[model samples]
Target: MAYQTFRQEYLQVPPVTRAYTTACVLTTAAVQLELITPFQLYFNPELIFKHFQIWRLITNYLFFGPVGFNFLFNMIFLYRYCRMLEEGSFRGRTADFVFMFLFGGLLMTLFGLFVNLVFLGQAFTIMLVYVWSRRNPYVRMNFFGLLIFQAPFLPWVLMGFSLLLGNSIIVDLLGIAVGHIYFFLEDVFPNQPGGGRLLRTPSVLKAIFDTPEDDPNYNPLPEERPGGFAWGEGQRLGG
Candidate 1:
């Protein structure tokens, strides 16, 4: 009975978020069970280019280390913001969302070649949080019930939390940079004077994942509010 209930809820998540989060969890589980090792997953330029271990490009963003506090923390933020982006502005635009994932992942891989970092799951999670926070700028956030700030400050708060934990802030910075690049190109630039569409999703991606916007029966998810709150009313969260 519990399994059936779980299946129903899982099916209801927006498709992109559902698939990505499931992959992350399963990858971690694979490591936990020792079916694979982090050594096989971490990003390595030589392995990817010279040895052609192409899978590392994707795997480096999946495993978040063994299950514990750090794992749970990153997973919570990842699932929350990823789902929010999918169900909010990205509703009915699965192909574009997938493209954003591809863009961010590729950009991070390019950056990883020069950096000493290994696993990139946490950085990817920060990118999602950054993008979501920007789109829902008016939303209010409560950090562990101690600090209350508007949504725009969320990525920084996460970075600060990372500092408190003694982890490097470089990963968070990388996510922020990529997230900003995406947000600016997609949301900001097109609206500026003389700026036209720049980051359009390719026709092939649209053909594969998006129903034509003009379809007579086409429907988008209903009653979406930025950050899950009405634009005027805004949002308040303890997440």
Candidate 2:
């Protein structure tokens, strides 16, 4: 699904989501034009590097390479996970989700850079926001065209494969750490109930928001009328 559609249906989107998505598009375009130096923002260097751009904190979220199966697969997972979170949160509270996502991404990148400078000469952080969001280990997703399985094992599986192939384990570990922190913080401060009994429903929202019995969902309904209180202001009462 397009970002616009998600925004409309969800009724709110955190500013960071827009920033991250924009960064991804720009970074991909630059890569297509043979711009490699700009992509270096994803890494950390010894001492103070001139190429060190502060904007990379946000751009890092968007620098996921070009259009391929990898990108498509990642996007699909992102959409599914993001949408699930959005739907569970109170109506009109997209900012909270965005904050958590960007904050996690930024920390993961920073940790990756530090590890690279200290141990390995190069490191690449994997986005672990989706994995962290899967608080329930039982949550599952369809793999390829056949398999349907849980995600908790997927991260470990990927990490194992990467290690076997001599990939950057440092970056992967840092990403997991960052993801854990994000999950922890989110559990502490959550969105408030919009206004309904739906908030009382036994779901993630109830657990996060700690909504009271009086709190109403306030979610817009189809039959609800909009605008001024009186439908017919000037109509004659006894004609």
Candidate 3:
């Protein structure tokens, strides 16, 4: 896909992207207040148990440590991936991407809370991002000027390293399993026309969902007003 064309086609940034970035900013503020700690929410059973807050599932993504480099690196990675996805599927329809990202994170968190309670704090976000990157592996990136492959298998390498470093391999495995299941489900119950055909044009939404389609919405430009332009063109100059 032509990156320039894709970028040109997108007139506006997706709402979900804006919302996510805003949340990250807010998290940074909260962290500075010392009112909350990112790591505490992840591994502390007491914090989770006492607070009993459900928002942690989603808020956890926004939590970055005080380490400026780590936080910047994560934000850059997220921006690159999200921009590629948003541009690739034009019309700024980010509903599905947002849904999948959050849903994947939620699933990972729940799995951590239950199956791998020991690594709850250590492995949630990384696993979720790994799974997402795996499923959408065709999206490539250049690492340090060297062409590095991503999308399908690179996630495993990351997961392996995380395991070697003594992080929760179990949560990573669970993420991979869930990602595969999501892929299979999409293949089976495919999105069809007649679903949200007006506001978004069902074909656009289908592409956003990454569903296979017999016909695709390739008209990247907005539709022209019927006969309106022709009438204007035919009129005498300055009349």
**Which regions in candidate 1 have their CA more than 4 angstroms from the true location?**
212-239
Instruction: Give per-residue lDDT, candidate 1, residue 184.
Output: 93
lDDT of 3: 0.49
Stretches of model 2 off by over 4 angstroms after superposition: 1-19, 35-40, 45-52, 89-91, 117-133, 145-148, 160-166, 188-239
- For all predicted structures, in order, the TM-scores are 0.89, 0.54, 0.55
Cα RMSD (Å) per model?
A: 4.2, 14.8, 13.9
Choose the strongest candidate by TM-score. Answer: 1
By lDDT rank, best first, the candidates go 1, 3, 2
Pairs of colliding residues, candidate 2: 24-62, 195-216, 196-215, 196-216, 196-217
Model 2 global lDDT (CA atoms, 0 to 1): 0.44
What value of lDDT does candidate 1 attain over all alpha carbons? 0.83
Candidate 1 matches the true fold with a TM-score of: 0.89
Q: Which digits, one per residue and each the tens of the lDDT, describe model 1 over residues 43-68? A: 98999999999999999999988999
The TM-score that candidate 3 achieves is 0.55
Q: Which pairs clash (backbone N, Cα, C closer than 3 Å) in model 3?
A: 137-151, 137-152
Question: Where does the lowest 10-residue lDDT sum fall in candidate 1?
Answer: 223-232
After the best TM-score superposition of candidate 2, give how far the Cα of residue 128 lies from its true spot, in angstroms: 4.8
Query: Model 2 over residues 1-239: C-alpha lDDT tens digits?
Result: 69889777544432333344445556678877777544454544432256555555544455554677545544543433344344454234544554455466556555656554332111122344334334535444333324434555545544554586586666456655665555544543354344222111234533564334422543432111111212101111121
